[model samples]
Target: MKKLTGVMAQALTIDEPVVLTGTAPHGILVCDGGSLDLRGGVDDRLTIEPGGYVLLSGSCQATVSIHEGGLLEVAGTLSGAVSRNDGELWAMSGSCIHGRTLSAAGFFIDLEADATPQEDAPRFRLTGTGHDLGIAD
Candidate 1:
């Protein structure tokens, strides 16, 4: 696992898992496969394309756009605008998203609050197609 503890000035293509232990104030664009372990802060606009998965345990002070085939797993705190267009958002317990969440009919959302008190966190199946969400048109 590669670690980035500073600013990310350019876009990154994640073929391997990368850990952000610092701050990405410049933001970035991610596409195609791999994981982003965000343990710090990411400002500006963050856009995740298809096949990208992000685990945010820190803070984000910008807008996040997740398209199809992307996933955002919040385990800590998320404060920013998050928009999902056919993406998946799995919010764990004790995590807070102070920003707005925008999603149409094709997004997959499983909040931590929906789980039973005995359950840790509910993980929704991400492979559900658009047809299942009635967005086949």
Candidate 2:
């Protein structure tokens, strides 16, 4: 179990799969020069760099900022809501089981109130081929 405390790491390299479980108190996990494989069940807040791919596998929540020319892929089930402050959020056409993103990249304009709770329970945005939401072309 690797843990990062209040520190600013740069040029980090992840040869194998890395799992960030604990919390970073007032710290920033920056990947200045390296490739990070974000596993599932990630429940933390961190800043991702350009060309960085954050793959969600389980229940996770984070305030991610995807810089210009960055790619954040949300794979598997996102138990919690994924809020992309900016940039592109790519989702599989036939993927995602029981979850929903607060906003997607290059499509959503409003971020302040995108995930406002309209129902009693947390809304899960999962569908099979864009049929659940009746969004078709």
Candidate 3:
């Protein structure tokens, strides 16, 4: 596993494993065959390509896109507008996401208790295309 701090993968491309620290840029792109350990926040978007995997322990301010065959394990908060993950998403207890019951593929989501103070209306739609992005460009 390679360690990359501060910087993240842009919309260009990558095919290896890298770890990032601190506040990553707005747009992050993780290409196929790549592995990313993101320990920061995304102000815009994060996209995981097919065959790509990401372990994000940060915050998202916009959207997150996980393509087919992609997998995301989040241990942070997603306070973004709306996101579309057409892949797998895994979230652990104490994590926070507006899409508490968001389901696009196979995933285990455990949102914070405070997310739903009471019985939700039971129908909420997340709009916009996934905010996917970062570096290599």
Candidate 4:
């Protein structure tokens, strides 16, 4: 597990599975073809390069851009503008997002379990072109 403060390097390449926690605003250029498990409160602009995989399990308030071949899986709370250009974005159950706008040009998958919405549960938004975007029956 790695703890991140203010300011991060433009590119980050991880080999093994790792968890990263952000303490402040920052930007990440690429994950460098690694699996990244991210958590914490981030309020800034985030960019994922091609072949980067990111899983969000905390609260994020930033504009996110997923480049070609990048993958973003959300299981928490996300609030901001999201743009996916030939990438993938997945919003799982128990995750919520209050996005200003979502522009996707690749793949968007929304998975949901059969359950009622809680009062303080997360919400997700899907817009633009995609293949799969609906509740699973």
lDDT tens readout by residue for model 4, 5-44: 4445443445445576753355444466566777765556
Model 3 lDDT tens row, 28-90: 778889988777776676778899987766776656777878887756566664366677765
Model 1 lDDT tens row, 1-103: 8988876776555656899888887786767777899888888777778898888777777677788788877665566666554687665544554532212
TM-score of each: 0.68, 0.43, 0.64, 0.61
Candidate of highest TM-score: 1
**RMSD, each candidate, Å?**
7.2, 10.8, 9.2, 7.8
| Top-down lDDT ranking | 1, 3, 4, 2
What is the TM-score of candidate 4? 0.61
Candidate 1 stretches greater than 4 Å from native: 9-15, 99-137
Reference-based lDDT, residue 47, model 3: 78
Model 4: residues with Cα > 4 Å off, grouped in runs: 1-17, 99-137
Estimate candidate 1's alpha-carbon lDDT, on a 0 to 1 scale: 0.63
Q: Write the per-residue lDDT of candidate 2 for residues 13-118, one digit (tens) a residue.
A: 3332355433333322435343344443443454556555554433334444555444444444333333343444444332242343333321222224224322
lDDT of each: 0.63, 0.38, 0.59, 0.56
Q: Is candidate 2 or candidate 4 better by lDDT?
A: 4
Q: Candidate 2 clash total?
A: 1
Weakest 10 consecutive residues of candidate 2 by summed lDDT? 128-137
Best by lDDT: 1
